[model samples]
Target: FRKVVHIEQGGLVKPERDDTEFQHPCFLRGQEQLLENIKRKVTSVSTLKSEDIKIRQDSVTKLLTDVQLMKGKQECMDSKLLAMKHSFSS
Candidate 1:
Protein backbone atom coordinates (compact mmCIF):
# COMPACT_ATOMS: atom_id res chain seq x y z
CA PHE A 1 0.00 0.00 0.00
CA ARG A 2 1.05 3.61 -0.53
CA LYS A 3 0.80 4.32 3.20
CA VAL A 4 3.19 1.47 3.99
CA VAL A 5 5.55 2.61 1.26
CA HIS A 6 5.56 6.14 2.66
CA ILE A 7 6.25 4.90 6.18
CA GLU A 8 9.10 2.69 4.95
CA GLN A 9 10.66 5.52 2.95
CA GLY A 10 10.43 7.87 5.91
CA GLY A 11 12.06 5.30 8.16
CA LEU A 12 14.90 4.83 5.67
CA VAL A 13 15.58 8.55 5.50
CA LYS A 14 16.53 8.59 9.20
CA PRO A 15 17.74 5.05 9.57
CA GLU A 16 20.60 5.98 11.91
CA ARG A 17 18.68 8.16 14.32
CA ASP A 18 16.83 7.05 17.42
CA ASP A 19 13.14 7.78 17.07
CA THR A 20 11.54 9.95 19.72
CA GLU A 21 9.43 8.15 22.32
CA PHE A 22 6.22 9.60 20.96
CA GLN A 23 7.03 8.50 17.44
CA HIS A 24 8.69 5.21 18.31
CA PRO A 25 5.71 3.52 19.84
CA CYS A 26 3.37 4.49 17.03
CA PHE A 27 5.85 3.50 14.37
CA LEU A 28 6.47 0.17 16.07
CA ARG A 29 2.79 -0.55 16.31
CA GLY A 30 2.34 0.34 12.66
CA GLN A 31 5.13 -2.05 11.72
CA GLU A 32 3.60 -4.81 13.82
CA GLN A 33 0.23 -4.30 12.19
CA LEU A 34 1.80 -4.41 8.77
CA LEU A 35 3.56 -7.65 9.64
CA GLU A 36 0.39 -9.19 10.95
CA ASN A 37 -1.53 -8.17 7.87
CA ILE A 38 1.11 -9.67 5.62
CA LYS A 39 1.14 -12.87 7.62
CA ARG A 40 -2.59 -13.22 7.51
CA LYS A 41 -2.68 -12.51 3.80
CA VAL A 42 0.05 -15.06 3.14
CA THR A 43 -0.89 -17.84 5.56
CA SER A 44 -4.60 -18.06 4.80
CA VAL A 45 -4.35 -20.24 1.74
CA SER A 46 -6.74 -23.05 2.45
CA THR A 47 -9.55 -21.66 0.35
CA LEU A 48 -7.60 -20.43 -2.62
CA LYS A 49 -8.23 -21.91 -6.04
CA SER A 50 -5.37 -22.84 -8.34
CA GLU A 51 -5.57 -19.54 -10.22
CA ASP A 52 -5.60 -17.59 -7.00
CA ILE A 53 -2.57 -19.52 -5.81
CA LYS A 54 -0.72 -18.67 -8.98
CA ILE A 55 -1.54 -14.98 -8.58
CA ARG A 56 -0.38 -14.96 -4.99
CA GLN A 57 2.82 -16.72 -5.95
CA ASP A 58 3.51 -14.15 -8.63
CA SER A 59 2.97 -11.29 -6.18
CA VAL A 60 5.17 -12.88 -3.53
CA THR A 61 7.91 -13.52 -6.03
CA LYS A 62 7.83 -9.91 -7.19
CA LEU A 63 7.92 -8.68 -3.62
CA LEU A 64 10.92 -10.89 -2.86
CA THR A 65 12.75 -9.61 -5.91
CA ASP A 66 12.12 -6.01 -4.94
CA VAL A 67 13.36 -6.64 -1.43
CA GLN A 68 16.53 -8.23 -2.76
CA LEU A 69 17.17 -5.21 -4.97
CA MET A 70 16.63 -2.84 -2.07
CA LYS A 71 19.03 -4.85 0.08
CA GLY A 72 21.68 -4.67 -2.60
CA LYS A 73 21.24 -0.91 -2.91
CA GLN A 74 21.57 -0.46 0.83
CA GLU A 75 24.73 -2.55 0.89
CA CYS A 76 26.21 -0.43 -1.89
CA MET A 77 25.38 2.77 0.00
CA ASP A 78 26.97 1.42 3.18
CA SER A 79 30.09 0.44 1.29
CA LYS A 80 30.32 3.92 -0.18
CA LEU A 81 30.04 5.45 3.27
CA LEU A 82 32.80 3.19 4.60
CA ALA A 83 35.05 4.07 1.68
CA MET A 84 34.50 7.75 2.31
CA LYS A 85 35.34 7.27 5.98
CA HIS A 86 38.53 5.45 5.12
CA SER A 87 39.61 8.14 2.68
CA PHE A 88 39.10 10.81 5.32
CA SER A 89 40.97 8.81 7.97
CA SER A 90 44.02 8.42 5.75
Candidate 2:
Protein backbone atom coordinates (compact mmCIF):
# COMPACT_ATOMS: atom_id res chain seq x y z
CA PHE A 1 0.00 0.00 0.00
CA ARG A 2 1.15 3.57 -0.72
CA LYS A 3 0.01 6.72 1.04
CA VAL A 4 0.27 10.20 -0.35
CA VAL A 5 -0.30 13.19 1.88
CA HIS A 6 -0.61 16.61 0.40
CA ILE A 7 0.75 19.38 2.52
CA GLU A 8 1.25 23.12 2.05
CA GLN A 9 2.97 25.77 4.13
CA GLY A 10 3.80 23.34 6.91
CA GLY A 11 0.15 22.43 7.28
CA LEU A 12 -1.84 19.38 6.28
CA VAL A 13 -3.93 19.66 3.17
CA LYS A 14 -5.32 16.27 2.26
CA PRO A 15 -4.30 12.65 2.29
CA GLU A 16 -4.42 10.40 -0.77
CA ARG A 17 -4.04 6.69 -0.38
CA ASP A 18 -3.51 3.87 -2.85
CA ASP A 19 -2.83 0.19 -2.77
CA THR A 20 -0.40 -1.70 -4.96
CA GLU A 21 -1.67 -4.16 -7.49
CA PHE A 22 -2.70 -7.61 -6.36
CA GLN A 23 -0.56 -9.33 -8.98
CA HIS A 24 2.54 -7.36 -8.09
CA PRO A 25 5.94 -9.04 -7.80
CA CYS A 26 5.68 -9.40 -4.03
CA PHE A 27 2.36 -11.28 -4.31
CA LEU A 28 3.83 -13.53 -6.98
CA ARG A 29 6.75 -14.34 -4.72
CA GLY A 30 4.35 -15.55 -2.05
CA GLN A 31 2.66 -17.77 -4.63
CA GLU A 32 6.02 -19.20 -5.59
CA GLN A 33 6.79 -19.98 -1.99
CA LEU A 34 3.47 -21.78 -1.63
CA LEU A 35 4.23 -23.87 -4.70
CA GLU A 36 7.66 -24.78 -3.36
CA ASN A 37 6.08 -25.86 -0.12
CA ILE A 38 3.64 -28.07 -2.00
CA LYS A 39 6.54 -29.71 -3.80
CA ARG A 40 8.19 -30.43 -0.48
CA LYS A 41 4.98 -31.88 0.87
CA VAL A 42 4.76 -34.24 -2.08
CA THR A 43 8.33 -35.32 -1.60
CA SER A 44 7.72 -35.97 2.06
CA VAL A 45 4.66 -38.08 1.34
CA SER A 46 6.58 -40.05 -1.22
CA THR A 47 9.16 -40.80 1.40
CA LEU A 48 6.46 -42.32 3.68
CA LYS A 49 6.70 -39.48 6.19
CA SER A 50 2.99 -38.95 6.75
CA GLU A 51 3.37 -36.59 9.66
CA ASP A 52 5.76 -34.35 7.78
CA ILE A 53 3.43 -34.36 4.81
CA LYS A 54 0.48 -33.28 6.94
CA ILE A 55 2.48 -30.48 8.54
CA ARG A 56 3.71 -29.19 5.22
CA GLN A 57 0.25 -29.28 3.73
CA ASP A 58 -1.14 -27.32 6.65
CA SER A 59 1.57 -24.73 6.34
CA VAL A 60 1.07 -24.38 2.61
CA THR A 61 -2.66 -23.94 3.03
CA LYS A 62 -2.20 -21.22 5.63
CA LEU A 63 0.27 -19.33 3.50
CA LEU A 64 -1.91 -19.51 0.41
CA THR A 65 -4.93 -18.32 2.37
CA ASP A 66 -2.95 -15.40 3.72
CA VAL A 67 -1.80 -14.41 0.26
CA GLN A 68 -5.33 -14.56 -1.06
CA LEU A 69 -6.64 -12.37 1.75
CA MET A 70 -3.89 -9.82 1.19
CA LYS A 71 -4.54 -9.69 -2.51
CA GLY A 72 -8.23 -9.17 -1.91
CA LYS A 73 -7.50 -6.35 0.51
CA GLN A 74 -5.12 -4.70 -1.94
CA GLU A 75 -7.66 -4.82 -4.72
CA CYS A 76 -10.33 -3.33 -2.49
CA MET A 77 -8.01 -0.54 -1.41
CA ASP A 78 -7.03 0.20 -4.98
CA SER A 79 -10.63 0.51 -5.99
CA LYS A 80 -11.33 2.83 -3.08
CA LEU A 81 -8.39 5.02 -4.02
CA LEU A 82 -9.55 5.19 -7.59
CA ALA A 83 -12.95 6.32 -6.42
CA MET A 84 -11.44 8.93 -4.14
CA LYS A 85 -9.27 10.26 -6.93
CA HIS A 86 -12.26 10.58 -9.19
CA SER A 87 -14.23 12.38 -6.55
CA PHE A 88 -11.41 14.81 -5.80
CA SER A 89 -10.70 15.48 -9.43
CA SER A 90 -14.29 16.32 -10.14
Candidate 3:
Protein backbone atom coordinates (compact mmCIF):
# COMPACT_ATOMS: atom_id res chain seq x y z
CA PHE A 1 0.00 0.00 0.00
CA ARG A 2 1.42 3.32 -1.06
CA LYS A 3 1.27 5.90 1.72
CA VAL A 4 -0.39 9.01 0.35
CA VAL A 5 1.12 11.76 2.53
CA HIS A 6 -0.95 14.52 0.90
CA ILE A 7 -4.57 13.51 0.41
CA GLU A 8 -5.13 16.80 -1.36
CA GLN A 9 -2.63 15.80 -4.11
CA GLY A 10 -5.03 13.09 -5.37
CA GLY A 11 -3.00 9.86 -5.04
CA LEU A 12 -6.13 7.88 -4.31
CA VAL A 13 -5.25 4.53 -5.92
CA LYS A 14 -5.39 5.19 -9.65
CA PRO A 15 -5.14 2.28 -12.13
CA GLU A 16 -1.71 1.52 -13.48
CA ARG A 17 -0.84 3.24 -16.77
CA ASP A 18 0.28 -0.07 -18.43
CA ASP A 19 -1.45 -3.27 -17.38
CA THR A 20 -0.40 -5.30 -20.42
CA GLU A 21 1.72 -7.77 -18.40
CA PHE A 22 -1.10 -8.43 -15.94
CA GLN A 23 -3.65 -8.81 -18.71
CA HIS A 24 -1.65 -11.51 -20.50
CA PRO A 25 -3.43 -14.89 -20.58
CA CYS A 26 -0.20 -16.85 -19.98
CA PHE A 27 0.47 -15.00 -16.76
CA LEU A 28 -2.99 -15.78 -15.41
CA ARG A 29 -2.79 -19.44 -16.43
CA GLY A 30 0.70 -19.79 -14.94
CA GLN A 31 -0.55 -18.35 -11.65
CA GLU A 32 -3.44 -20.85 -11.57
CA GLN A 33 -1.07 -23.71 -12.35
CA LEU A 34 1.21 -22.66 -9.57
CA LEU A 35 -1.68 -22.66 -7.10
CA GLU A 36 -2.91 -26.04 -8.31
CA ASN A 37 0.57 -27.56 -8.04
CA ILE A 38 0.97 -26.30 -4.49
CA LYS A 39 -2.42 -27.78 -3.49
CA ARG A 40 -1.65 -31.12 -5.15
CA LYS A 41 1.74 -31.36 -3.42
CA VAL A 42 0.20 -30.62 -0.05
CA THR A 43 -2.50 -33.24 -0.55
CA SER A 44 0.03 -35.88 -1.57
CA VAL A 45 2.19 -35.16 1.45
CA SER A 46 -0.77 -35.37 3.76
CA THR A 47 -1.81 -38.68 2.22
CA LEU A 48 1.70 -40.03 2.74
CA LYS A 49 1.64 -38.97 6.36
CA SER A 50 -1.70 -40.69 6.92
CA GLU A 51 -0.48 -43.86 5.29
CA ASP A 52 2.66 -43.78 7.39
CA ILE A 53 0.59 -43.44 10.53
CA LYS A 54 -1.53 -46.42 9.59
CA ILE A 55 1.54 -48.49 8.84
CA ARG A 56 3.07 -47.61 12.18
CA GLN A 57 -0.10 -48.55 14.01
CA ASP A 58 -0.31 -51.88 12.23
CA SER A 59 3.32 -52.69 12.96
CA VAL A 60 2.96 -51.86 16.63
CA THR A 61 -0.14 -54.03 16.96
CA LYS A 62 1.56 -56.93 15.26
CA LEU A 63 4.61 -56.59 17.50
CA LEU A 64 2.53 -56.59 20.65
CA THR A 65 0.57 -59.62 19.50
CA ASP A 66 3.78 -61.46 18.78
CA VAL A 67 5.09 -60.64 22.21
CA GLN A 68 1.89 -61.88 23.84
CA LEU A 69 2.12 -65.17 21.94
CA MET A 70 5.73 -65.64 23.03
CA LYS A 71 4.82 -64.89 26.63
CA GLY A 72 2.20 -67.65 26.66
CA LYS A 73 4.62 -70.16 25.17
CA GLN A 74 7.28 -69.24 27.68
CA GLU A 75 4.88 -69.81 30.55
CA CYS A 76 3.96 -73.22 29.19
CA MET A 77 7.66 -74.11 28.88
CA ASP A 78 8.34 -73.06 32.43
CA SER A 79 5.56 -75.29 33.76
CA LYS A 80 6.90 -78.22 31.77
CA LEU A 81 10.40 -77.65 33.16
CA LEU A 82 9.06 -77.63 36.74
CA ALA A 83 7.18 -80.89 36.16
CA MET A 84 10.30 -82.50 34.71
CA LYS A 85 12.36 -81.37 37.68
CA HIS A 86 9.88 -82.85 40.17
CA SER A 87 9.81 -86.15 38.28
CA PHE A 88 13.59 -86.37 38.30
CA SER A 89 13.74 -85.65 42.05
CA SER A 90 11.07 -88.26 42.92
Candidate 4:
Protein backbone atom coordinates (compact mmCIF):
# COMPACT_ATOMS: atom_id res chain seq x y z
CA PHE A 1 0.00 0.00 0.00
CA ARG A 2 1.23 3.47 -0.82
CA LYS A 3 1.32 6.17 1.80
CA VAL A 4 -0.67 9.37 1.44
CA VAL A 5 0.49 12.77 2.62
CA HIS A 6 -2.37 14.64 4.23
CA ILE A 7 -2.11 18.38 4.82
CA GLU A 8 -4.45 20.76 6.64
CA GLN A 9 -4.26 24.27 7.97
CA GLY A 10 -4.37 24.83 11.74
CA GLY A 11 -6.24 28.12 11.25
CA LEU A 12 -5.15 29.50 14.61
CA VAL A 13 -3.06 32.32 13.29
CA LYS A 14 -4.32 35.83 12.59
CA PRO A 15 -2.97 36.80 9.20
CA GLU A 16 -3.06 40.52 10.05
CA ARG A 17 -0.88 40.13 13.15
CA ASP A 18 1.79 37.90 11.64
CA ASP A 19 4.21 40.70 10.79
CA THR A 20 3.99 42.34 14.19
CA GLU A 21 7.08 43.50 16.12
CA PHE A 22 7.13 40.37 18.28
CA GLN A 23 7.72 37.83 15.51
CA HIS A 24 9.95 39.87 13.20
CA PRO A 25 9.80 37.97 9.90
CA CYS A 26 6.46 36.37 10.85
CA PHE A 27 6.75 32.91 12.47
CA LEU A 28 10.50 33.59 12.83
CA ARG A 29 12.00 33.76 9.30
CA GLY A 30 9.22 31.37 8.26
CA GLN A 31 7.01 28.59 9.54
CA GLU A 32 8.27 26.61 6.57
CA GLN A 33 11.78 26.64 8.03
CA LEU A 34 10.59 25.18 11.30
CA LEU A 35 8.25 22.65 9.68
CA GLU A 36 10.30 21.67 6.64
CA ASN A 37 13.72 23.43 6.74
CA ILE A 38 12.58 25.65 3.92
CA LYS A 39 13.80 29.24 3.66
CA ARG A 40 12.34 32.32 1.99
CA LYS A 41 11.71 32.06 -1.70
CA VAL A 42 14.68 34.32 -2.62
CA THR A 43 17.18 33.63 0.13
CA SER A 44 19.85 31.06 0.90
CA VAL A 45 18.11 27.79 1.70
CA SER A 46 20.73 26.45 4.05
CA THR A 47 23.65 28.25 5.62
CA LEU A 48 25.22 24.91 6.57
CA LYS A 49 25.73 24.10 2.92
CA SER A 50 28.41 26.01 1.01
CA GLU A 51 26.57 25.48 -2.27
CA ASP A 52 23.62 27.45 -0.89
CA ILE A 53 25.70 30.39 0.31
CA LYS A 54 25.92 32.21 -2.97
CA ILE A 55 24.18 35.61 -3.00
CA ARG A 56 22.24 36.87 -5.97
CA GLN A 57 21.54 40.57 -6.62
CA ASP A 58 17.83 39.92 -7.18
CA SER A 59 17.40 38.24 -3.81
CA VAL A 60 18.51 41.25 -1.75
CA THR A 61 16.92 43.63 -4.22
CA LYS A 62 13.51 42.06 -3.79
CA LEU A 63 13.75 42.37 0.01
CA LEU A 64 14.61 46.03 -0.18
CA THR A 65 11.85 46.59 -2.69
CA ASP A 66 9.32 44.96 -0.42
CA VAL A 67 10.34 47.10 2.54
CA GLN A 68 10.25 50.30 0.52
CA LEU A 69 6.87 49.46 -0.93
CA MET A 70 5.18 48.53 2.34
CA LYS A 71 4.20 52.09 3.20
CA GLY A 72 2.63 52.68 -0.20
CA LYS A 73 0.78 49.40 0.00
CA GLN A 74 -0.62 50.27 3.39
CA GLU A 75 -1.76 53.64 2.15
CA CYS A 76 -3.56 52.11 -0.80
CA MET A 77 -5.17 49.52 1.44
CA ASP A 78 -6.31 52.17 3.90
CA SER A 79 -7.93 54.27 1.18
CA LYS A 80 -9.60 51.25 -0.37
CA LEU A 81 -11.00 50.16 2.97
CA LEU A 82 -12.29 53.65 3.76
CA ALA A 83 -13.97 53.88 0.40
CA MET A 84 -15.52 50.49 0.84
CA LYS A 85 -16.78 51.30 4.32
CA HIS A 86 -18.45 54.46 3.05
CA SER A 87 -20.00 52.69 0.10
CA PHE A 88 -21.12 49.81 2.27
CA SER A 89 -22.84 52.11 4.75
CA SER A 90 -24.42 54.21 2.03
Candidate 5:
Protein backbone atom coordinates (compact mmCIF):
# COMPACT_ATOMS: atom_id res chain seq x y z
CA PHE A 1 0.00 0.00 0.00
CA ARG A 2 1.28 3.48 -0.87
CA LYS A 3 1.48 6.29 1.68
CA VAL A 4 -1.21 8.97 1.35
CA VAL A 5 -0.51 12.70 1.54
CA HIS A 6 -3.13 15.18 2.62
CA ILE A 7 -2.59 18.81 1.60
CA GLU A 8 -4.34 21.42 3.70
CA GLN A 9 -5.46 24.62 1.98
CA GLY A 10 -8.00 27.23 2.99
CA GLY A 11 -9.29 25.20 5.97
CA LEU A 12 -9.75 22.17 3.76
CA VAL A 13 -7.69 19.00 3.81
CA LYS A 14 -7.60 17.12 0.55
CA PRO A 15 -5.66 14.04 -0.40
CA GLU A 16 -3.12 15.04 -3.00
CA ARG A 17 -0.84 12.11 -3.76
CA ASP A 18 -0.21 8.51 -2.87
CA ASP A 19 3.57 8.72 -3.20
CA THR A 20 6.14 9.55 -0.53
CA GLU A 21 8.67 11.01 -2.96
CA PHE A 22 7.22 14.52 -2.66
CA GLN A 23 8.19 14.82 1.03
CA HIS A 24 11.92 15.35 0.58
CA PRO A 25 13.45 17.52 3.30
CA CYS A 26 15.96 19.35 1.08
CA PHE A 27 13.34 20.21 -1.53
CA LEU A 28 10.94 21.59 1.11
CA ARG A 29 13.69 23.71 2.64
CA GLY A 30 14.70 25.13 -0.74
CA GLN A 31 11.08 26.02 -1.55
CA GLU A 32 10.67 27.78 1.77
CA GLN A 33 13.85 29.77 1.25
CA LEU A 34 12.81 30.82 -2.23
CA LEU A 35 9.44 32.04 -0.94
CA GLU A 36 11.10 34.05 1.81
CA ASN A 37 13.53 35.66 -0.62
CA ILE A 38 10.67 36.62 -2.92
CA LYS A 39 8.81 38.22 -0.04
CA ARG A 40 11.83 40.29 0.95
CA LYS A 41 12.40 41.52 -2.60
CA VAL A 42 8.74 42.50 -2.99
CA THR A 43 8.78 44.40 0.27
CA SER A 44 11.96 46.22 -0.67
CA VAL A 45 10.65 47.27 -4.05
CA SER A 46 7.35 48.46 -2.54
CA THR A 47 9.14 50.62 0.02
CA LEU A 48 11.41 52.14 -2.61
CA LYS A 49 8.43 52.98 -4.84
CA SER A 50 6.57 54.62 -1.94
CA GLU A 51 9.59 56.71 -1.02
CA ASP A 52 10.10 57.75 -4.64
CA ILE A 53 6.51 59.01 -4.85
CA LYS A 54 6.91 60.99 -1.65
CA ILE A 55 10.09 62.60 -2.91
CA ARG A 56 8.43 63.63 -6.16
CA GLN A 57 5.50 65.14 -4.27
CA ASP A 58 7.83 67.12 -2.05
CA SER A 59 9.75 68.43 -5.07
CA VAL A 60 6.50 69.53 -6.72
CA THR A 61 5.37 71.36 -3.57
CA LYS A 62 8.69 73.17 -3.30
CA LEU A 63 8.55 74.17 -6.95
CA LEU A 64 5.02 75.56 -6.49
CA THR A 65 6.12 77.63 -3.53
CA ASP A 66 9.09 78.95 -5.45
CA VAL A 67 6.83 79.99 -8.32
CA GLN A 68 4.50 81.81 -5.93
CA LEU A 69 7.41 83.68 -4.39
CA MET A 70 8.64 84.72 -7.83
CA LYS A 71 5.15 86.00 -8.71
CA GLY A 72 5.02 88.07 -5.52
CA LYS A 73 8.44 89.54 -6.26
CA GLN A 74 7.40 90.40 -9.81
CA GLU A 75 4.28 92.23 -8.55
CA CYS A 76 6.31 94.21 -6.04
CA MET A 77 8.86 95.16 -8.71
CA ASP A 78 6.07 96.25 -11.07
CA SER A 79 4.58 98.48 -8.34
CA LYS A 80 7.97 100.04 -7.64
CA LEU A 81 8.64 100.69 -11.34
CA LEU A 82 5.24 102.37 -11.74
CA ALA A 83 5.89 104.64 -8.73
CA MET A 84 9.31 105.61 -10.11
CA LYS A 85 7.81 106.37 -13.51
CA HIS A 86 5.12 108.58 -11.95
CA SER A 87 7.70 110.58 -9.96
CA PHE A 88 9.99 110.95 -12.96
CA SER A 89 7.08 112.03 -15.21
CA SER A 90 5.95 114.68 -12.72
Candidate 6:
Protein backbone atom coordinates (compact mmCIF):
# COMPACT_ATOMS: atom_id res chain seq x y z
CA PHE A 1 0.00 0.00 0.00
CA ARG A 2 1.20 3.56 -0.88
CA LYS A 3 0.35 6.80 0.96
CA VAL A 4 0.01 10.21 -0.77
CA VAL A 5 0.83 13.59 0.83
CA HIS A 6 -0.91 16.87 -0.14
CA ILE A 7 1.05 20.13 0.44
CA GLU A 8 -1.16 22.61 -1.45
CA GLN A 9 -4.29 24.03 0.14
CA GLY A 10 -6.54 23.79 -2.91
CA GLY A 11 -7.06 20.99 -5.44
CA LEU A 12 -4.75 22.76 -7.97
CA VAL A 13 -1.21 21.36 -7.99
CA LYS A 14 1.80 23.46 -9.00
CA PRO A 15 3.87 22.22 -11.94
CA GLU A 16 7.14 22.85 -10.00
CA ARG A 17 7.92 22.70 -6.32
CA ASP A 18 8.69 25.93 -4.47
CA ASP A 19 12.44 26.41 -4.12
CA THR A 20 14.23 27.98 -1.15
CA GLU A 21 16.07 30.44 -3.42
CA PHE A 22 13.23 32.96 -3.70
CA GLN A 23 14.26 36.60 -3.39
CA HIS A 24 13.24 38.73 -0.40
CA PRO A 25 10.70 41.53 -0.91
CA CYS A 26 13.23 44.20 0.05
CA PHE A 27 15.82 42.81 -2.32
CA LEU A 28 13.29 42.80 -5.21
CA ARG A 29 12.33 46.38 -4.43
CA GLY A 30 15.98 47.44 -4.37
CA GLN A 31 16.53 45.77 -7.76
CA GLU A 32 13.55 47.63 -9.20
CA GLN A 33 14.90 50.94 -7.85
CA LEU A 34 18.30 50.24 -9.36
CA LEU A 35 16.71 49.51 -12.74
CA GLU A 36 14.81 52.80 -12.60
CA ASN A 37 17.99 54.72 -11.75
CA ILE A 38 19.77 53.15 -14.73
CA LYS A 39 16.90 54.11 -17.03
CA ARG A 40 16.98 57.72 -15.84
CA LYS A 41 20.74 57.91 -16.35
CA VAL A 42 20.42 56.55 -19.88
CA THR A 43 17.72 59.09 -20.75
CA SER A 44 19.81 62.00 -19.46
CA VAL A 45 22.88 60.82 -21.36
CA SER A 46 20.86 60.50 -24.57
CA THR A 47 19.56 64.02 -24.17
CA LEU A 48 23.04 65.36 -23.60
CA LYS A 49 24.28 63.59 -26.74
CA SER A 50 21.46 65.14 -28.78
CA GLU A 51 22.29 68.59 -27.47
CA ASP A 52 25.99 68.10 -28.23
CA ILE A 53 25.20 67.13 -31.84
CA LYS A 54 22.98 70.17 -32.29
CA ILE A 55 25.71 72.47 -30.98
CA ARG A 56 28.26 70.92 -33.35
CA GLN A 57 25.91 71.37 -36.32
CA ASP A 58 25.40 75.03 -35.47
CA SER A 59 29.16 75.57 -35.23
CA VAL A 60 29.67 73.92 -38.63
CA THR A 61 27.01 76.11 -40.23
CA LYS A 62 28.58 79.27 -38.82
CA LEU A 63 32.01 78.20 -40.02
CA LEU A 64 30.69 77.56 -43.53
CA THR A 65 29.09 81.01 -43.67
CA ASP A 66 32.33 82.67 -42.54
CA VAL A 67 34.27 80.73 -45.21
CA GLN A 68 31.85 81.92 -47.93
CA LEU A 69 32.24 85.55 -46.80
CA MET A 70 36.03 85.21 -46.82
CA LYS A 71 35.92 83.77 -50.34
CA GLY A 72 33.88 86.73 -51.60
CA LYS A 73 36.31 89.20 -50.01
CA GLN A 74 39.31 87.38 -51.58
CA GLU A 75 37.72 87.52 -55.05
CA CYS A 76 37.14 91.29 -54.76
CA MET A 77 40.72 91.89 -53.62
CA ASP A 78 42.11 89.81 -56.50
CA SER A 79 40.19 91.86 -59.11
CA LYS A 80 41.42 95.13 -57.58
CA LEU A 81 45.04 93.88 -57.62
CA LEU A 82 44.80 92.88 -61.29
CA ALA A 83 43.41 96.30 -62.27
CA MET A 84 46.22 98.04 -60.34
CA LYS A 85 48.87 95.90 -62.06
CA HIS A 86 47.51 96.64 -65.56
CA SER A 87 47.35 100.39 -64.88
CA PHE A 88 50.95 100.40 -63.55
CA SER A 89 52.21 98.49 -66.62
CA SER A 90 50.46 100.87 -69.09
Model 6 Cα lDDT, one tens digit per residue, 6-50 = 555232655366532333333455366644333211355556777
Q: List model 3 lDDT by residue over 4-74, tens digit each.
A: 23444345665455232213223344377644333211355556777788899999999999999999999
What's every prediction's RMSD, in angstroms? 20.3, 26.1, 15.4, 20.7, 13.7, 18.1
TM-score, one value per model = 0.47, 0.47, 0.47, 0.29, 0.47, 0.47
List residue ranges in candidate 5 displaced over 4 A. 1-48
Which candidate number has the best lDDT?
1
> What are the clashing pairs of model 4?
none
Model 4 CA RMSD to the hidden true structure, in angstroms: 20.7
lDDT of 1 by residue, 1-90 (tens): 223333644755755545443222234543666444442124556777999889989999999999999999999999999999999999
Best of the two (2, 6) by lDDT: 6
Clashing pairs in 3: none
Of 1 and 2, which scores higher on lDDT? 1
Q: Show the colliding residue pairs in model 6.
A: none
Residue-level lDDT of model 2, residues 6-36, one tens digit each, is 3432235332443322222233554666444
List model 4 lDDT by residue over 1-90, tens digit each.
Answer: 122222332345445433322222334443655644433455445644654344565678888999889988999999999999999999
Residue 38 error, candidate 3, Å: 25
Q: What is the alpha-carbon lDDT of model 4 when measured against the actual structure?
A: 0.58
What is candidate 3's local distance difference test score? 0.64
Candidate 5 lDDT by residue in tens digits, 40-62: 11355556778788999999999
- Report residue 25 deviation for candidate 4 (angstroms): 46
User: For each candidate, what is the lDDT?
Assistant: 0.67, 0.63, 0.64, 0.58, 0.65, 0.66
Q: Candidate 2 — which residues are off by over 4 angstroms?
A: 1-48
lDDT of 5 at 37: 31
